[model samples]
Target: ISFNAIDSALSSLKNCQSYINSGMDVATQVALDLVESFNDEEDVNNMEKVMLEYATMDRELNHYIKAFEETINQVKREKPENLPDLENLAQEKFLEMESKNSDLDFQRNEKYMYFKDQLKEMKKQYHGNDTIEEIDEDIAVTRSQMNFICPITQMTMKRPVRNKVCGHTYEEDAILEMIQTQKQKKKNVRCPKMGCSHVDVKGSDLVPDEALKRVIDSQKKQ
Candidate 1:
């Protein structure tokens, strides 16, 4: 399939996932309220299992879709058999299919195991106190951990530029100036992000993180 077709399908899958997750969230709130009003342990346990199954099913379907998309993109980029004489590359095609399947299996197994670990952690919760407030707290903490702010300026990045070498990001002007100052002095500036293994920043190593910039813009509007 064409890249546009693959992207459209992925978009649809993402929308479906969001729809399911919204419904699951509503159902969870209702379930929790019901359990609280009735104070029934059995119903709470059953409802939790149903919620887990529903979320897991949605996640699993999306994972397979993502794997398929990745495989197609890989095939286009790598072109396993681009020989002009070999018009019939059936064996090469089969090999690509096999590789895709292998990747799908590996990813599914790894994520499922991680999911089970999450379930175990949930089971360890003293009670179902992981409510909306708790969820909001978790979300906030997660966002704080994300690299939305530039390390150089200690501010929210307006134009985030990511280092290709170290996978860390900084504000575009700030990082460029840092690089320029070092180059003029005949020295290299290490990555600003603490504990980075990457030796130094190069002008070529920085690229605009357009995807992250969009996210930041959306959040600002919100």
Candidate 2:
């Protein structure tokens, strides 16, 4: 495929993602409406079921997008010239990529999960049967999902940055300040997360953790 074709394919994947996100937003709104508009158990259950069916579609579509992203990236990096080679390469890489991933990743996707949790609350309100036990379970699970506290600042991270080297995140300013301090001392800092083996921290190793930030923001709103 031509380079323009590759770029267009990637752009199409992005549009797919955007449409999925829009669907999620609409689902959340529908859940809200159902909560207020229905008191019948069967009706509410059916609406929730329909909502979940769309959610499943979203999950499957996202998986396809990820698989295609992996295939296209491999094709671009290798720069295969001919049609047969590109077709074979894409198929082989797609199977390899699909083998390494599953629907679970999309289920745990931050934006989707965030919308799901909101829908759950609306469901609870619609049913008017949220037991203390279930709420307790939700609290416990939410606590265990992620640690938003920055290792360097020991506070809830507002702008988290993750290290590409170790998959650990810290508050952006705090990590940058630490980096600046270490540079002034003509030395390097290790990844601050305990038990991490990354020996040196560099600015290039840190990237913005936008997904984590969105999760954190959603938690704060709750």
Candidate 3:
């Protein structure tokens, strides 16, 4: 028979044989060595057989390192609104890997570490910053999902008022005071939220006095 026929027979035998049998141990061992040893087209036939069996014997043996990362991405895409839940998942997986990974030099071990560190940092940035949290909370409330982070500053905001449109809301009180000043000038002003420059006529009419009006308006806006 030709080398091709012999190669085909070996491939078939590798798949047909039971890996656990005692007599087949030597064959399995040789197949594994061949998988790692050969580096030519002629070796491809044997290599495929060896790899298929290895994968069949242990499905996760080659894919263990990527499991957590895949899981993280899956959760993030499927349920972005449940950021807290995602955060918990990240923490749980990170802790589990850290506790289990005594051998940091392993390729899978390093990947796990890297994934865990990234999750921790993202969680911290999401939770620690107040502005970001407020915006996230609002977005979560309205959209029932959270993806709003300042592109430039990475801050969470709620009804993020830009300075260019209606000036800025340096403080709730400051905004209130601005409304009072606008009223004094006979130019009714509205909340700067939503980038609108329009003064609030209903708001101006609601207050007993301009000073009290500003306070009530500020409270309503918040």
Per-model TM-score versus the true fold: 0.37, 0.48, 0.17
For candidate 2, write residues 26-94 as lDDT tens digits: 665665555556556566456556655666666655656666666667766776665445455556655
Residue-pair clashes per candidate: 0, 0, 8
Question: Which portions of model 3 miss their true places by more than 4 Å?
Answer: 1-170, 201-222
lDDT for predicted candidate 2 compared with the true structure? 0.65
Looking at model 3, which ten-residue stretch has the lowest summed lDDT? 136-145
Predicted model with the maximum TM-score: 2
lDDT of 3 by residue, 1-222 (tens): 123543454455454444423322443334333323433424534533543444333323223333445555666567655344534564566556555643323323322222222222232333344423322221111211223333223443333322222222223334456667887898866644454454552332221111122323344678
Full-model lDDT for every candidate: 0.58, 0.65, 0.37
lDDT at 86, model 1 = 26
Which 10-residue window in model 1 sums to the lowest lDDT?
136-145
TM-score of 2: 0.48
lDDT of 1 by residue, 136-167 (tens): 12111111223678989999999987675666
In model 1, how large is the Cα lDDT of residue 102? 38
